[model samples]
Target: MDEKRLIEQKIFNDTSTYNDIMNVPYHQSKRHLPMNQLDRAFQFAPFGALEGFNDLIQEKTELYERKKYTTSETELTIERQLKYLQAHSLKVDVNYFNDESGYYEHFKGYLKSLDWKKGRADFDELSVAILNIRSIKLIKK
Candidate 1:
């Protein structure tokens, strides 16, 4: 019989002999040799390669989707600040218009017509102060 066929027949027919052959140090060493080299090569690759691949994929998806900031927290914050500034400016305008002696009564009428629900308490207080000053000025007039 050929050597290879003899070994194959031994492996199939003799369990103890097959186990001894498999347990040999030379065969054991060969099993781990390639695996150790593969592990070392993977460890030596650049640290950011995997991370860069993920980032590149994310950027491409964002471009494909045309990602936007419509619902972003910062955008909402900026919109709220703009509304507050508009309300605050209205309060300041009412105060400035009320400061002129002749326009006091007209300013009081305008203040009464404003929607205070959308404005801050600071704006409300400034508006009230303007109305009060107008009242005083009317009394003096």
Candidate 2:
């Protein structure tokens, strides 16, 4: 046989070296109980070395993906629609820019009230700031 096979044969033939310990039982700790598979798995689990880094990256990505808005382009259209809708309650779909998330949010609900002095638009469920409104379309019943 080749060198590898010869070595394996020799080792297999000579089992006396490990024979003393071959039948020895495994040792167990008395003070601590054995961990379950899941508990043991968590011992080798990966951890976040840099806390809040993911949140920072997400905030940065949202800022880059934000849609740019100009008052000149949409102000006149939104104002006219607002004036028309102010007279009566109506179901409307509104797309407005969210300053907190730097994104546009779509809201569909019944318009309840509008405050010109405070610059706020109240819906049945929630209220949105007037200046942040991008487009407002009345839902025809």
State each model's CA lDDT, in order: 0.42, 0.82
Q: Which stretches of candidate 2 lie over 4 Å from their true place?
A: 1-67
In candidate 2, clashing pairs total 0
lDDT of 1 at 120: 22
TM-score of each: 0.20, 0.49
Quote model 2's TM-score. 0.49
lDDT of 1 at 27: 41
Expressed as tens digits, the lDDT of each residue in 32-88 for candidate 1 is 545677678877887746767888777666553522323355445434543455444
Best by TM-score: 2
Instruction: Residues 1-141, candidate 2: write the lDDT tens digits.
Output: 899999998988888899899999999999989999997887776674566889989887776477666577587888778878778777889998776777899899877888989999888787888888888887888
